[model samples]
Target: MALAHRILTIRRDPHSGEVLARGGDPEAHSLLERSGFVPVVRRHETYHRLPTGLDQDEEIRLATRAVARLQTVGYDLDTDPVFATERREPHYLSLGDQVRHLAVRIREAESTEEVADALTELTATHDGILAALTKVLHTAADFLQDLGHPADPHTAARLRHLADERLHVLASDLRHVRNDLADRQAVHPHRAPCPQEVAGDEREKSASCPCPAPARIPTTPSAPAAAPPAPAGRRR
Candidate 1:
C-alpha cells in the first residue's frame, strides 16, 4: 500500500544538532514545507535536524507531543517501527511488547493504506513467533515423553504449558489483525486500473496500441498447518 501521508522520525543529537535518524516520504516533506515545524536543512535531507540542547529523553518527549498534536488534527505521522527508540534489539522484546506495538499501530493508522501496512507487518511477525513457540512446545513434549521415568517432570510440563498459552495469545492477535485488515480493505478497496486510460492520453496512442486487462486472482482459505503432534502419552 502506498503511504498517503509521509510521517518520519526525526532523531538528532541533543547538543551537536547532528541528525541521528531522518527519513520521510515526499508527502511528508511537502507537508513539512507548509507547516510551522521548521526543520534545519544542512548539506541535504539526511543532515536536516532540529537543534536542541535538551536531554535526549526530553527531546523525545517533545517530539512525541508534537506528533500527537499533528495526529489530533488528522495528520498521519509515521512513528511506529521507530517510535522514540530506534530498535528494541529483538532479543529483549517480550511477547507482550510485540502485541502492544501492533495494537498501537493499528489504532493509530488513519488510512486504509496505513492499516494494510500495519496488518502485513503484524501477520509476518506473529507467524514467525507462533511457529517458534509451537516448536518449543513440541520439543518439550517430546522430552517429557522420552524421560518417562526421569526426575524433574514438572519442568518440562511447565515449559509446554507456557508455550501453549503464548501460542494461543499470538493466534488471537493474528485473528484480530486479520479482521482489522479485512474491515479496512472493505471500506477502502483498491481501485482497479483502467488499462486503456493508463496506456496513454493521446488519441493516436490509444487507437494504435492495445493493453490486456489485468487478471483477477481468486482467494481461497487453505487448511491450517498442523502443529507437531504431542507425544503419544500427552494430550494434544
Candidate 2:
C-alpha cells in the first residue's frame, strides 16, 4: 500500500497568523476557496508517527477520535465491520490463545534453554502479527483514497490496484506464518526430547515422526517455465 501524502494547506484566522490543517480531499479546499479564502502553496505536513505498545482499548480510542474528527467535517469514516466483527476480533483472540499457550509452556519449561526458546518464538510471532496489522492499515488508507469521493479518479484507481496487490501479498505471508507456527506447535507439543529418547534402542529410523526435525517437508515444487505467446496481428 502506498503511503498517503499529508497535504498541508494554509488557512488564516480572523486575528491570528497562518495555520495549517492536514488536507486530504479537494472538496475541502474548494469549500474554503468559495468562502473567500485563498490556498497558499506550502510544504505538506509530515506523516504522523504511529504509537507503539498500544493496547486494544487505546487503539479503539484513537480510532474513535479520528472518526469523530472526520465526522465533524461531514466525512463518514466508519470502521470496517469485517475487521471488528470477523477478522480482527478472531485474530486477537487467537493471539491471546497463543500467548496463553506460550505462558503455559514457559511455566512448565524444564530448563532455562526451553523457556528462552519458547519466549523467542512467542516474540517473533507477536512481531509478525504487528507487521501484518501495519500492512492492513496501509491497505485501508489506500482503499479509502480509491473511493474517489474526494480524490482524482485516475490516481485513486491506480492506488487502489497497488493496494490490492500489496494486501494480497501481505495476507499470504501472514497465512504462511500462522500455518508454520501452528504446524510447529502441533509437531513439538513440548520441548525437544531428552538424550535418553534419542539413545533408546526402540527408537525407529522413520522420517515421518511427529517431532521437530532438522529438515522441513517441502510443501510444493516450482512449475515448468511456460513459453511466451506470439504477438497479435493488427486488424485491417
C-alpha TM-score for every candidate = 0.27, 0.24
How far is 78's C-alpha from truth in model 1 (Å)? 39
Full-model lDDT for every candidate = 0.54, 0.46
Which lDDT value does model 1 have at 148?
65
lDDT at residue 171 of model 2 (Cα atoms): 51
lDDT of 1 by residue, 62-135 (tens): 45544544454444544533233332121234465676697787676556656666666545554654666677
Candidate 2 Cα errors over 4 Å, as ranges? 1-16, 20-151, 186-236
Error of 2 at 54 (Å): 31
